[model samples]
Target: MKPITALFAATLLASATAAVADDNLEKLGQFKTTGASPEIPTIPQTGPKADAIKKTLAKIKLPSGFKISLYALVPDARHMAVGPQGVVTFVGTRKNKVYAVTDRAKSGVADDVKPFASTIDLSIPNGPCFSKDGFLYIVEQNRVLVYPAAEFFYESPDVVAVPIVPKGELIPKDEESYNHTARVCRVGPDDKLYITLGQPFNVPAPEKLELYKKWGIGGIIRMDRDGKNREVFVNGIRNSVGMDFNPKDKSLWFTDNQVDGMGDKIPPGELNRATEAGQNFGFPWYGGGKVRTNEYKSETPPANVVFPQVEMDAHAADLGMVFYTGKKFPKKYQGAIFSAQHGSWNRTDPVGARVMVTYLKEDGTADKTETFAEGWLTSDGEYLGRPVDVAMLRDGSLLVSDDFAGALYRISYEGH
Candidate 1:
């Protein structure tokens, strides 16, 4: 498990970019890609930057008996996937790097943070998810790559990388977007890989809606582990950066960022539930809740367009979420949904640089939503740190990523 040489890194990148579809993962899994040479760079665990990030956390507010601490210094940390063994956490970014943050000593705070597979050319590698069986899947702008046994072997530079969806195949290259291109994924209860594809435009032209629907853009799609049997799971979503499966019914729940430019107060954000495949969640026809987007207001929305289960305040820019399945939290917090509000960028008065918790009723539907953590926004409308995603560690402690801060914060509960 030695580090790869600079020559090997460059060669591997070329091969991966040129003929990624021809990769023989089964053969590569046999340690055929091993090499020895330069080690990847690791972010400093303690430095001025880390200390600066900690000072900002002092302003963060959580419920009683809870504490927040700096977990890792991950650059552009967007969504996160905790390893099955709790040995490592693969964090995705809106840029080209996928970081591996490790708490190898089980010290509660991460001691090591470094780029995973630093040689590979990653494009907006914003979604990293793990299956229970030890595979790490990273969904990029137009490709999906999986690393076998990623949790245990990510330290090695030559760890096997396999493509689930080859380059430029996740979506049409012509429709690729810089905005709304940050994807998120999860391994579902049924062992399928679910990914969200955000449609590029603020609101697409009416003529392109049908094409977007057909291509699964601005929606969620599912496929087998090997990237076979791919199909659109849900449609009519504008831009969903986060999703997760409910432990209760195994149904899919997600947060969608509604269309902009429809005024600051109209058309609230959405949290939706998809009980079955091929369901539409109401996009262009109804922007958010029953508020219709002006672009397609005159047109008739598809029949049976399912609306949001909970309509949040407009322009909160809701992103990643996870279900609470850990035991360390109190019973009241168990089974609740924890989500991140990335906050609004263009609103005259900013809102939602916080973490949210949604409680569910006995019937498994959302009962109510409330703020769980706040103070990322200052009184003067300046953002101290914009929360991006929330993930659960094996110990039931919560890890929240902030791209604005380039760091991760850990929240643990200790009863009085």
Candidate 2:
């Protein structure tokens, strides 16, 4: 990828564990520790609801039998994750902060959005989620921090990590690295872990570049809790801010951000299915694999990798997706995918900033997509908040984390 400006290409932060062994194909990233203490950065206050929050969500349209509510309004809530125990946690890093919200209170709204743990300077976030044991994990620009959910909350706000980037895998000093962290993470059905690290930039590193040839830096990778046996699960993903696996088939899925300026609709974001172990979806070279307007289409074209299973609009910025395993909706939604469209600015009128439900065929292909939840994006371009992540409770109610609103919204089917 071409080198960007200093601000956009901020200094590479600390790289936690990447699936690499420094073999012939490994150039692990290392974040040189700085002499700075982590202080709670000022949380970006929502200020106050400029208008009734409903006015923001009012224009959104959705399928029948679905309803949305203003769960709670907090601050800059970024990403979120839910554990088997029903405890939910999320991160917002405009000022390097983290929070935990729980449904245990029974109101189905986030009562308290409190700090889980954080650092003094990191501004980016990897989103948050957990393993079955109630261990919580949050990611900053360069590191993925893990903490026990129960221990971190109620008992103590301090989070003790299970593991961070191991000692030897740091990126060599003089190499170009993207460290585009903050890719979403989820636990696959096989009881293993999977996470996304975005493309270094919109394009792949120039050919024959040592760093690119070494460990594949700009794509998604899978690993175990020990951070061992790491491997690139997919490639050509410019960014996958939102992701989740199908609970039914155990297939890997993610939403890759679109390549910018490709018009308003051509290179839509991607909803991909990692069919095989080593699939490479087309990126930089004709996103969504369509052979139009995408300039790189003429490039040699990758022969080995699978394209996305579904295509969303350009700059839709689909951030989080979860398969509906709950019985709350019609039986047809048994395994559908609900994606949160964070919305976009570079576009003319705005495309995302709502939840989309992609209808899934038995074979795992997405046949149709619909608006499951609306109101985040406005027709006039004003938004109350951006929904970042989606998770289903044990009772099948759905929880959506709104970074713009700084609260968690729960959607449950009350009608019989």
Candidate 3:
């Protein structure tokens, strides 16, 4: 699938989300960074980016009282993680460096972006998870690498271990079949490492969709921390670039990408709970609560096959998810899920590209979804940036990274 051109997103955001949405976009002090901003107002302040930054920030729409502040300027920053103290780890495309940014809460915004490890580059590195035991694990296209939490910011990286593909499963081989963003390998409740393997190919051709469906081309895989005892945890799942372990019951949950070219308003993306190992969720069949055309004779999955609990807009590319366990926000935000939608390239309505909050039920299911942060999509659908992941600060505020902008933003509330 081609990257959603900025030109197409402009039209989609207008007729699609504008009519059905309720939240407002927010405007922080914007910089005249090079991007789209034709519909925004003029910035009032004067500085290096007085015009562009103020204008972009002013045009932002959010949920009333919340405001955003630019945190740090990164060059090609991707997924990130917060370590002990205020240490922040970021994956930068510039010279393939994994940088660490640290600051004390009392010090506030003065915290500078620190360099954790460099002198090497990893291929499209995705997920960066910190183990409770003080180790940082990041996944590369070919394998998963673990590093000492202490050595992350000060010294060169030392590869601790690398996980291998399962015995019978069709994990990606050498350079011949390098998958994009193998994503993060998380430590499940049982201390097992759960790695999300995305689909190697795009929507299967009509004649081959059914054949690949049973082959389990895309889904979740679990293994020991040292890369042993691998098993297929679930099947019938399209690409799940973002996934996490539900803290309440230790169940696995993930957001799946829906196939495109099936036309608008059908076969939407999904937010699913992997209730049990080996459970099957509809993939090539039903998506985002809507049915799509398939060559399969039945097209519909068996009743026993579980569908998503909450379906998202088709192609809304939900990435990086974490449950709110900190006390920085109001009590209402506790135990909820915060996910970053990288935005959509295929949909007629340019959905996602912002961070969203889905309040979980007492039983740990999504009760309602709310916009935690906005500004990724334009009223006319032009994309200013795409949020890749959300890292929670110890103080309860959130640190969001935009790969497009190569920058980080912090969102913290002032009053109750």
Q: Give stretches of model 3 more than 4 Å off.
A: 1-55, 92-97, 104-106, 114-116, 150-170, 174-182, 205-217, 287-290, 297-303
TM-score, candidate 1, is 0.93
Give the backbone clash total of model 2. Answer: 18
The estimated TM-scores of all candidates read 0.93, 0.80, 0.77
> Who is ahead in TM-score, 1 or 3?
1
The best candidate by lDDT is 1
lDDT by residue (302-391, candidate 1, tens digit) is 999999988998999999999999999988899999999999988888899999999999999999999999999999999988999999
Q: What lDDT does each candidate get?
A: 0.89, 0.62, 0.63
Estimate candidate 3's alpha-carbon lDDT, on a 0 to 1 scale. Answer: 0.63
- Quote the lDDT for 162 in model 2: 42
Ranking by lDDT: 1, 3, 2
**Cα RMSD to native, each candidate?**
5.2, 7.6, 13.0
